[model samples]
Target: MSARVTMKDIAAELGVSINTVHKALTGKAGVSESVRAKVNDKAEEMGYHRNTSASSLRRKDINLVFCLPCASREGAYFYRYLWEGCNRFEQEVIDQGISIERVEFVVGGYADALEHIDERLQVGEKIDGLLAYVPGDDRATHLLEQIAEAGVAIELVDGDRPHFDRLGASLADYSTAGSLMAEQAANLVHASGADARVLLLAGDPYTDSHYLTARAFHNYLRDHNVPWQVEDLTGAHAQVKQLERELKARLSSSEAPELICSVFAVGSELVADTLVSANKAGEVMVIGNDLFPESALALRRGIFTNIVYKDPVGLAYRGAKTLGDYLLWGKTPADPVQKGAVEMVFASNVDRYCKLAGI
Candidate 1:
């Protein structure tokens, strides 16, 4: 049999232990830079190319995969940021000369995501790393474990998973920032009236992180003893219109909600649109989520009083940079990349920071 040009072969050529090769390959905690350089030099001289296929037999790519359980742009209100971020990531990677693949896996239950993983493996599409904007759920956890076992480094971009740190990457804490927006909404209600009821519209379930804002809103209201009802309005435009009518009826009734907080773009825009058409725009205190085009319009028209905007372009730039760093240098992200918060947007800055994205 032809001798395989493996890490072991490189180690043997350098008269070093196999563990040394492992350290050299991973550039892990203890190895000196000089030693790493030497190993790399020797491996190169020995014509040792990393056999990704062979590596998959024992381990898999640690490069990266950006998985969006379900890439539902129209149906998912929060998908705007995810799509924008991933698109930015692709551009950034190409600019940086890194070999990383970003795939939007159809979002399904744990079983479905796992099935996708299996399909990728079957096709011999090796994944060394995965960046996901996943929901916080058991099924997500299981799929994460399976991906880890395959030796792919995983980062949850805008969500949290209990075992994400163990997966050798990191998670951006949207929940923390979401709480801030929620608190703002609470304050809006407080200013409006303590007896004022509220209606919170949530984004799609495509990623749990998107709903973090809603969860935070709920908590804030509960803490303040404010009465509120939450609804999820995700899907087609017709469905959104239907939800708007339902919300309108509730708002128009004698027991109408005084404050409407939208935690998703579609739903928020729907609420705003409904209010405008009903000529009840200024009657209700309105807050919208994610300053997409529609939300921006609503804000400009005075339909939405406040916006909890998330910077999709920033997320994309950072996610791509993180993936590139991991692939090129085997390094991890130093921060969430959004600075002081897991989420940042036009609403957070009085100077209109989102304009930097030119969107």
Candidate 2:
């Protein structure tokens, strides 16, 4: 099937900037009459369907609130990228009569943040749309319901609560990531032609992403008939010191796994550091998740075998844009869950990813 035509596609075909094409098509005053005619003619030739609903909405002001974890929180490495993406999107749409206000809370403080949002709504604050990384907790669910009932459109990012009637969601496909990591691990084990035990540093089981990743990893190995015993080191990502201690203990034990896998960015560096300290850096194969300064360095140093790169920045940007489009153009995402792209990073290509990630 042919894809829907977009302003970008039109601009590319006409050798013009997207902004110019947008102005011309939208009948904005900046575009010259000649250029507007050309654009309109090309749009018609290309079967562009103008959205009358969106045209009306573009004249209205939009106010959106972004609720997320603060960068100051420990183990917030991933959230930092999310913030960057959100800010980038904000800057891109700054001149479009759209206002994005950020509301940051400490990690694991969703209830507090939701309560604050509820209070603001009660005080007659005008919120056209809201984007948040809401977890599946009762208090969060209750507050989210209240906010939705208050006529505020909501879009979830990073995680999702399926029961909630949200506009849409932008989430990482952690199950696919986990399965990819498992395949990499199995390939490495097969290449060595030796039986090896695997340890999965699975972050909090309650979190949907973490739980799905861990389950997929285990299931993949089992389904493939891989002869590897998988063990889990389960805990919240924020408990850095505790996780480190537990990992260190396992590394020093008699039944220490030969392969270590981390499905999240939180403790990937810890895993590499512990392996280096225990003099098992190159001896044991390590599969990490996400690409940042630390993990990139670990990959370059041969301490990490591979990294399942979950593009958090892209996820956040897409999520914010999804909500923005819904508010400004009356457009809805085709799917309820929009999964961001994932990549596999190795030493040979880690530098390229690092540069792309602005690390």
Candidate 3:
């Protein structure tokens, strides 16, 4: 590493007083624009402005709250990775005197999260920043606005719901992922020498991620001149049996679908099970999203054409680090909207996702 460049060194290089350098760097009134510009340019050239971490240590330790969904067995594997990233980030900044508190939305939706924050406020707790999975809708928006009013910076994980410029987020490009899945499904249909009618199983209605992905997938199929129909399974997450019956009914037609694409991991698993039970696993092409362990196993078993893998762990890690940057040093991400990387997993590379899940 290069020797640490100090404000003193900047002042020396510019042949000015240290006070002038400080004022210029800090946007104070004492320095004239010409001299200020000179000092600023010299400081930039000399790499002198990264004392923020040390400065953070001089201030009070940061207090942040991480809010996320915690359900029974549903979405548990995904949340495990999100928690892993949060825990690892917590350890990374422990020496810097950063404390992260976790608050789970255990029983319900954003309303439960709102109650958690409200309870914190009731106890006179001060939240410096919040790193959470804020849903993309009015309820979450209204609640997040309330939290913003309470003077807490918000960082979104996996999805951006509020559409606020100041809100920090690290998520994946599900739109592109949707198109990729569509492409795979279309190719499978073409290879089968069958008509391109498909069953598109969508996600929860309240989830903008699912809606966005489903829309993109449908658009891609339409643009490619493929025929498909969508059924929004909003209650599938909570009504597993109902979802099963509905899926069975849909796939029970005399003219079997040549392809099936689902926006959610669970949706894909259900389709796989239904197809196997109906003795159509080899007859239909099933394309699914996410790297849930079951989905990975299915991909390896060739029940799935390919599983779209979005790095949720990476999203949580970056989201935590971004919140840390803002809370500890008053820094914001260069791009307020951060997106996660997406990949495709099949039999050839299902092992990578298995190791990621530690299964």
Give per-candidate clash totals: 9, 0, 2
lDDT of 3 by residue, 1-359 (tens): 78899876886787765556766886755457999899888888888765656665434577888888773476664666677778878889988877778877753576667767866865878777788786645676777766765556678887885444234788888888888888887777778788766777787766756777888888897897775554455554666688889778767877656777888766777878888897767667788877777777777777888877777777888999998886666566778788877777778988977787555
Candidate 1 structure quality by residue, lDDT tens digits, 86-205:
676666546444455545544355456655875685576766556666445677677666665444555555545544432232333456556766676667767766555667666554
Q: Note each model's CA RMSD in angstroms.
A: 7.5, 11.8, 8.9
TM-scores for every candidate against the unseen true structure: 0.68, 0.82, 0.79
Task: Evaluate model 3: give its TM-score.
Answer: 0.79
In model 3, which residue pairs have backbone atoms overlapping below 3 Å? Answer: 136-161, 171-340
The reply for model 3, stretches above 4 Å from the true place, is 1-60, 162-166, 227-234, 357-359
Number of the top lDDT candidate: 2
Point out where model 2 deviates above 4 Å. Answer: 1-55, 73-76
Better of 2 and 3 by lDDT: 2
- Residue 76 error, candidate 2, Å: 4.1
- Candidate 1, 97: how far from true, in Å? 4.1
Tell how far residue 35 is off in model 3, in angstroms. Answer: 28
